[model samples]
Target: MKKIIALLFGALLLLADTEFAEPKPSIDNPRKIVFPITHGDDESINHVLSSANNVMKFYGPEKVMIAIICYSKGIRTLLKKEKKIAARVRSLMTYDVEFIACGNTMRTKNIKKEDLIEGVEIVTAGIVELVERDLKGWIYIRP
Candidate 1:
């Protein structure tokens, strides 16, 4: 019985090893994830940031690509005026996390490119950007 139990434990250990499916994530083929932030509230913004950070921590920054698409009220998160939040964003950017802003939202809210944090990419439309990324096989996460 003891030998059998040990054998079973070894088999379980072998099964516990991490496994990746087709197109496995690696330095050359990293996992792509897009996060959409539509809410401007502090909690919501922080939550999304936290989620991205957690993913990076799990996969290691080099093994994963993360993009945060901000539109509508969510554009507030990319504003330079959001001091605390902007700092957090900047920190994430160091890890290669991309933050994208919607041009339509900026125009609607009278927000200029200079008003946003340096390094933010502006797209014609945030929703459309999300759609394109999805179609490209990037995971869409709304946290």
Candidate 2:
């Protein structure tokens, strides 16, 4: 009975480890940063992108893991109809930057996966995603 309980607990621990889904960090990229965007303005989006760009430039692409989580109006940044910022987003993706969209906003705004840009990942809740990343030692940037 003791061995069975230990094995079950181990399995539960392994499962718990997989709860926070995001890009894996390594020794090469020890710094993790999460950008939380709730406003859909172009300036805000660009500012966040610029900050991310600066970080990458400072640390070199291989030394940083950056993720942008968009919720509420910020989802506009990843919309398929959003062409103005697509170029900038695509440019960042080249350096392994991640863009995540909020499913709650998608449901309220009627946005489907096909409605988002090619590489945008959809998470259940953008704020929750931000919290998880923040708890996992990621620096939070509002811009």
**CA lDDT, every model vs. true structure:** 0.97, 0.86
Q: Give a tens-digit lDDT track for model 1, residues 1-143.
A: 99999999999998896777878788999999999999999999999999999999988999999999999999999999999999999999999999999999999999999999999999999999999999999999987
- Give the Å shift of residue 21 in candidate 1: 2.8
List TM-score per model, in order. 0.86, 0.78
Which residue window of length 10 is worst by lDDT in model 2? Answer: 17-26
Steric clash pairs (candidate 2): none
Candidate 2: tens digits of C-alpha lDDT, residues 1-143? 99999999999988873332455444554678888878888888888889999978876788789999989998998977888788888899998999999999999999999988899999999999998999998999875
TM-score of 1: 0.86
* Top candidate, metric lDDT: 1
**Per-candidate clash tally:** 0, 0
